[model samples]
Target: MSLTYTYFKMRKGFGRQPMFCMVKPEMVDNIMPDEAEQKKYCLRNPVNQESQAVLSQSQQEINTTRVVLTDTGINHLEGGWPKDIHFDDEETTSRYRRRIERDESYVDAIMHLTPKFEHYIDQNNAINMYDLFYKNMPSEDPVEKPIIRINNVFRDRQCRPTSSIGWTCEEDSKLVVSYCDKVFPINTPSRNTDLVGYLWNVELPSSPVDEFLPPVACWQVVCSPVSAPILLGGLEDGRVCIFDLRSGNSPQDISPEHIAHRDPVSALLYINSRLNNEFFSASTDGVCMWWDVRNISKPTEAMIMSVFSPIVNEYDLANAQPITTLQFDKAFPTRFLCGTDTGLVVNVNRKGKSHNEVMSAVFKAHYGPVKALHRNPSISKMFITCGDWRVNVWSDEIISTPIIPGQPQKYQINDVIWAPHRASSYMSVSADGRLRYWDFLRKYREPIVISRLSQHPLLKIKAHDNGQMIAVGDKKGVMYLVQLSDILVYSGNKDKPRMIQTYERETRREHLLETKIKEIRLKLTKTEDVGVEAPPIDEITEDFTSVESEYKRIVDEEVRNMGPGRTLSSSQLEKVKQEVRKR
Candidate 1:
């Protein structure tokens, strides 16, 4: 019979227990013989005599400190080292040099001729295990043991690895809400250093401009998609800011667009559209305003997804309660899901349509507020998150009852994040500083509690694409990174899935001068032969020059169009000069 063992970390104030990794005997076998020896060394080398006696007594009870193998251990077998251990000259020399230099090597060697070195050692007579074992046993085939990588936070950032925290905005604009004023690539990992990313300050306009703000409350650190730089952030007062990250210098004095909510705008999600360069803004106002970033002066359309609560019979849309969380289905960009202070999750499409039930089924999913909702990045029909005190998964197909029907109301889920690089797996952070992982496909009896460190009320959690690592932050502004294997010996299979290779055109930035020259040479070689009469070199050069010049002209035109003052109309010189003066 095999046993499954796990190491769980418990933090203070957590009402739920999280399971850690499951280990089996086979997985234990992967542990290096040296590691097992070290464990024995640690246990035997008690600091005091009393502990030493306890360790001695415990060692005799177990035949082997070997791990048990089970089905769960099979999963830990991935990525282990190959068998047949071989060490190079320097490594082998370094390992054996100390013992070889000692003349005691021979006296110790003969001690192996006897039945027990342990017997001599117990009597305070000096002898080594290797010397004793070698005389009785012959050398066996060297087995390469698994190397375990432990999980720990490692950073190369020079900045106080945890300081420099705040919202991030773009560096190019002053309006703070100008079409170009937004941070494009949010949460980008550092390539050269361990410092992950930096933050930017957004300056707001001074006054409220009717459901909009001049710049004051309208100023926000716009968070948008990576590809298109559209802003989606609510301001300090009660307005939402929308900026097109792709905006060029179109002498168009376009007012930075804003959406007003009767209550302060709490949650915002920047949504992409199939329509050309169009985007929309959703606010706690219970109204989602759709705008074509091409012209942000006004909303192209607006839809109110919430109305008065039928049970309470009051206009809830314009009340003080605001939206707490928002999310978009990556697969279904046009459809959005929102959670409000009223414990309601509303799913709406771009065309202002909901499910057939109209004001869809509202569930009392949480006793308190729903902090976050995440739709699976790789899957469209499923979503999961934490609210009140429970973590739950939802699928459009299975909606009859709650998964954990009677989770206590005292549990408060502080944050939820989908694993960056995996599917059907997610992690949640709680008010108690607990980080737990849930595999939707597994039994919900208990989740894999990866780690638990004392943390403040967790305000945010972010994962990379692979789910192998995660970054979490708390209200006190402390951030922590959870790496899957800082030190783990992958004892599993090594054959990884072959990645699909797709054809990609090389960009100028990716092409070196030598590469370009070689490509041109290849083109010329294909066009001419040594035996045949070659085309006139002058004619060829002239044709190439003309093509190059035409290409440059096209590029110049495109660049000029991107300049702010280049698009001014001939009849609008006064307008242009006035705009210039204002700038």
Candidate 2:
């Protein structure tokens, strides 16, 4: 399939240079024109005079096979023209293919097939795209016009999320949970069928829960082992709140039976969901504390103290290093792993005489900083996602290397998650925006399943237990729930990755409105501090009226795309897919 890239100037220039960027293949076409032709091209002194004069000098000039490489000659040569280089020798030797294929690391593998394109080219497809006249040198004409830029784009069928429930599960699920700008519904079709029955949101804000102050952050509900209900919640004022799923819903803050850390909770995991008291919480303050609900507010044990490096500590001890991930063993409740910005992986044993004690194995996991860590559910020795685009597997019995015995590459590892219910397999999202599934028991150089959904930079990924579906959320506030089979069969087989289906939602506009309202409320609250300047009640009323009008317009546009008929069926689905494929 061909990939078409629609370039938009986002922020215009970077360092006085064009901010050139590429869109993911799934967003456009991916096929390149394979035109094999031979031609001799030459650079011209003056772009306007000599070239025009020669062309008009005689009728034979019209049919002359010649190219004028103007000041843009530098770009033309660099772009991809048969100048100074022999096309016959290059193509025959497959030099281009060899250079791209040599990148065998995980990061290079995903980008290997990404179509290469030039930003600008002359009308004759010879001169540089950025050429302009400047003191006989070249004027930096930011606008690279009269450029023949051909993008290798191909059309494919549009895809859809397979879940019966909508992308966000907004059907009957009333409340939306937001973490770091990503929103996930508490009620999931695979886990809970009953909309109201799921205990996910009970702790956040319900009727009875209202008795207690609303939780500063939304509560995340997780299924213990199988069907047991457990709440891994964050509270306002940076506190971790663990709630008993059995606790009935009513907006009330049931103080946590165990207070584990002194920071806003970011992630929570139940060591053995079957066991009510066993759980762990990761905090923004870089504290990974273990707890038993029966215990006191303070943690009984903790792993890896949150401390700043010497340089940082010298200036400020309050803002220590931050913790990113903390996960417990899938089968063993006592064994666990924690990751941090410091890029160190601390393997620990909770059963030790002291709580949250690290095991002998602690090592640097990533090139830059570690972003995510997940232990495979099926294999004890195997886990995935350390940092840069690499995945590592470790065993108690270390060999020559601490990492998995395989070739490693550079790629931003944003998310590493075990395949739903499958420990032998795992799914990960890289900085390149590619989603790949791997099996430790299998070969390392190539992923068992690779997806080229590089358009949106995926920040989070969630897979269903059955392995039939996967959901990815990009940095752009767009969430995608894709059928696993579609990605595997489509991108894997055809060497092409296209969106099976997509639904995008953004809260920026709503957030802006909320910010305005909050500002007004703040002004009212601090009226005395502002010298009692009312600016006239009529003016205030007019300002509010204009705001309301703008709000209505924005809402109407968003609502149009999210109408009752927004629902799409198989017929309409295939039709849309065919349309996208044609383009």
Flag regions of model 2 displaced more than 4 Å. Answer: 1-177, 182-214, 218-230, 235-237, 242-251, 254-260, 292-322, 353-358, 405-411, 420-424, 439-443, 452-454, 486-583
The candidate that achieves the highest lDDT relative to the unseen native structure: 2
Estimate the lDDT of model 1: 0.48
Positional deviation of 492 in candidate 1, in angstroms?
11
Model 2 has an lDDT value of 0.49
The digit string of per-residue lDDT tens for model 2 on 1-583 reads 7688777665655556557888776656677655453235556887775344454454443467678776643334434534555655757447765765676684575665443433232333875557664658754523321111111211111221111111113222212222332223234322212222121221233221111123443323333343333344544334555444345443323345344345545566667666556667675566666666665366666654433232311334254556666767657656777776676666666555432243445656665556667764544555555676566655443322344433564666777776654334567777676777764434345677676764756666765545555656555434444555432312122111111110001123334555788899898879968678768899999987876666555545555776865655567555554554454
Question: Candidate 1: TM-score?
Answer: 0.43
Clashes of each: 37, 34
Q: Candidate 2: lDDT of 351?
A: 58
Give the runs in model 1 whose Cα sits over 4 Å from its true position.
1-223, 226-232, 242-259, 274-279, 307-321, 350-361, 404-406, 409-411, 440-443, 486-583
> Could you tell me which 10 consecutive residues in candidate 2 have the lowest summed lDDT?
496-505
